[model samples]
Target: MAKCTAVIDIGSNSMRMAVFQKTSRFSFHILHEVKSSVRLSEHAYKNDGYLQSATMNRTAQAIGEFLSIARSFGARKLLCVATSALRDAPNAQEFISRIQREHNLSIKVIDGEKEAYLGAIACANLLPKMDALTVDVGGGSSEFAVLRNGKVETLYSLNIGTVRIKELFFDRNDLAGAVAYIDNALSALPDFGIDTFIGIGGTFRALTRALMKKENYPLKKLHAYTTDDVRFQTFAEQILQAGPKKLKSLYIKTDRFDTIKPGTLILQRILKYTCAQKLVCSGVGVREGVFLNDLLRNSAASFPANYNPSVRYLLDTYATHSDHGIQCSHLVKRLFDLLQAPLNLKADYRHDLVIAAKLLPIGIGIRYYAYQRHSHNIAMSGLDYALSHTQIVLISHLLLFKKGSRSSSLIPRAGYGTLLPDNATVDALSAILWLSHILLAARINADTLSVHYIDGKLEIRGKHLYLAKEQLRNIVLPKNLIVVFQE
Candidate 1:
């Protein structure tokens, strides 16, 4: 086993340390993770170029603690990065010199474009196939990088972050002005033609937490979440109007309450201008990016195969109904194709629907009674798998319908844009998936269930599906259903 590698990220709002220990070939285990709210840029604005004395002292103490922990854990390599706050301070060089001389730790102040690129690398490792607009919102600046086909095409760094906005606009209670400031800063970047957006940093995480609570999301996992225009508008308004007292009631950390308003507005503005339909919340931020960079630098050949764990691997490793889930996915794809003409479902939407169908059964193993609810619960609760929030919401909706329920409104309250299938389409797919599961639960095997158009009617055929004599006789097929037996 290889020794752990640690990376320390000293940011304007927070400082964090993470350690990764090699577990096996192309696999690593997280050894330790810790974060502290140092807010090094808290009053750095008052000074010409260096962080205020108090802020610098607090940051140095945090770094010392992190370095001690890394050494105790026998970390062979350590990388420390400081972002905007330290980079912009007039006395940055002096501060860096003092830290290096006193602490024996080399600190690199990364530029905005490099920060955006590194963040994108971390995201790309997580979602290999996505065409994403990666947005990292930090204390002093927000970085944006467009990943087309898993490669960075464009990147920009803007002077807009939660702490920056809070310092500039919150005291005046000028919410509109804050929004304008963010919009103006972001407008300078050329459009990247992005349809999907991935958010990184504390503000994005805070937003995910708020959306999870509002929709009663079951999973605490953070990856991709879907937010619609309605949900976005509603939540944005709520956050804006909420006073500290009211916000605290929502269980948001007191320190985060003030920044939530401006952060939400910034996100809203990004979504509005980019026309992104889906938002993926990556838990990995600058720390993970830096760690990954070090990992690759140390041993490029030993890099993990899947940077972020996969849903399939998770289902196989931890889930009990993995086999059944695969069967359901296969069945759903067949039925989806059969009804595509009548349902008017686009190819991309159908692909997501099939994925939802396949993953639906993972929740049933929790408990038998109200398996529908359990299924819904598992899908939304971040299961340490690589799934966007929208995909999870869609899967939860399908699971609800699969268990003999018809509530299409059970989906979470994230902005999913147009990524979800229409209600009618979802209903139709759910009905077919449920019927197929009920028809083949006992006799499921290699044979595939299929639907077809025959003589102006939809027809279903499967070796085992027709063998259910009781269901064939008693089960009432929908008006559109036409059953055919193949001997």
Candidate 2:
């Protein structure tokens, strides 16, 4: 496998490229991404499904530039797939040959089922394990993948899409005809009894992004952001009723003005048919799915058990002393175990504490001063895979604790207060984490210290603990607790 692989998905409405560089086995991060709204199916739906010369030329030029950009990042492999437009076009072979002759880029035209499967693979592996129906609305087709227990069960694709519906029925002002077409197409799906809808592609993302802004969402992440079916259904209806001016007021971008209604309608119909209870927006689509399909070909198309890609990428790229991070991670858990029974702390918090300790030094890789702030930002932005928004925000908040700071002041100032646990819980967790750092400030082996909580005081017994004792002066112990250090 190449160290860097570039995956391209040429959709009917846009052509997108994502370049991924592997940090280690089964771990990688995106290096570059480029999207061009070529609208390759602009007139194809109405003109006997023949791709227009103008759009084809525009798409070819964009692909040429995408190739150059991928090479600039030293991408050693390129995987390009075409969906909807090319698969339906009568002159698709001509366009494919042109790109092959001019830029030496081969495009694999995938069928609707394969396209749905690709998107499902991305959601199955990258998202937290769930039983949901994955929906991907493209320009000329809408795809569906049934997921069961974190695996893809089946895939279905419909010819009803934004551009397809717009040209066939919406343009003629025949709303009844459009609804009939969508309903008839949806009748092909069997009842899966799934309530969750995992949305993939641009249409879902654009609508969700607008909602996030309207609600003043604290976090900037979109991948795992969730919304109930009723809230999204109302928003989708608003988009359907709104004209061009109203869409702009709703934060719909100018590029999406033409097809936004069609896409929204398609999702609304599917959600109603499937009896969806919730919708989770996925930032990754066919491009990411294609990349992982090849990358994890031998590993049952899934990451190793309990291995998080974001964690590995952070450690591989940012951690300067990974061994020390590992040592501290173990020490924090030991401390948490000793205090859990004493302080009445929930055992669930140990997960965040362990992860926080392991990633503590990630900020040092950016700068020695205030590296914790850097770690906080990195976790918020980079920890987008497989974790919920709450977990992501809590992990970042853990990095905000200083030697002596109140969680009450820190929680409000940091924001995202609604997504976090209570201040008392956070204060306790922060105190444990900070105390662990103090104990290992000298980078000593974790085995050197032996700690146990007895009655009201936590006993710390170790040799050569002079530096730890000195660092303890600035620390604040949790309420109803005291620290006793002895050599």
TM-score of each: 0.67, 0.95
Off by over 4 Å in 1: 297-385, 389-487
TM-score between candidate 1 and the true structure: 0.67
Residues 313-372 of candidate 2 have per-residue lDDT tens digits of 999999956577778888899999998877778897898788888888888888879888
Best by lDDT: 2
- Cα RMSD of all models vs. native, in order, equals 6.4, 1.8
Span of 10 residues, lowest total lDDT, candidate 2? 406-415
- The sequence of per-residue lDDT tens digits that candidate 1 reaches over residues 317-358 is 335644766676676677767766765666665655666555
| Residue pair clashes in candidate 2 | none
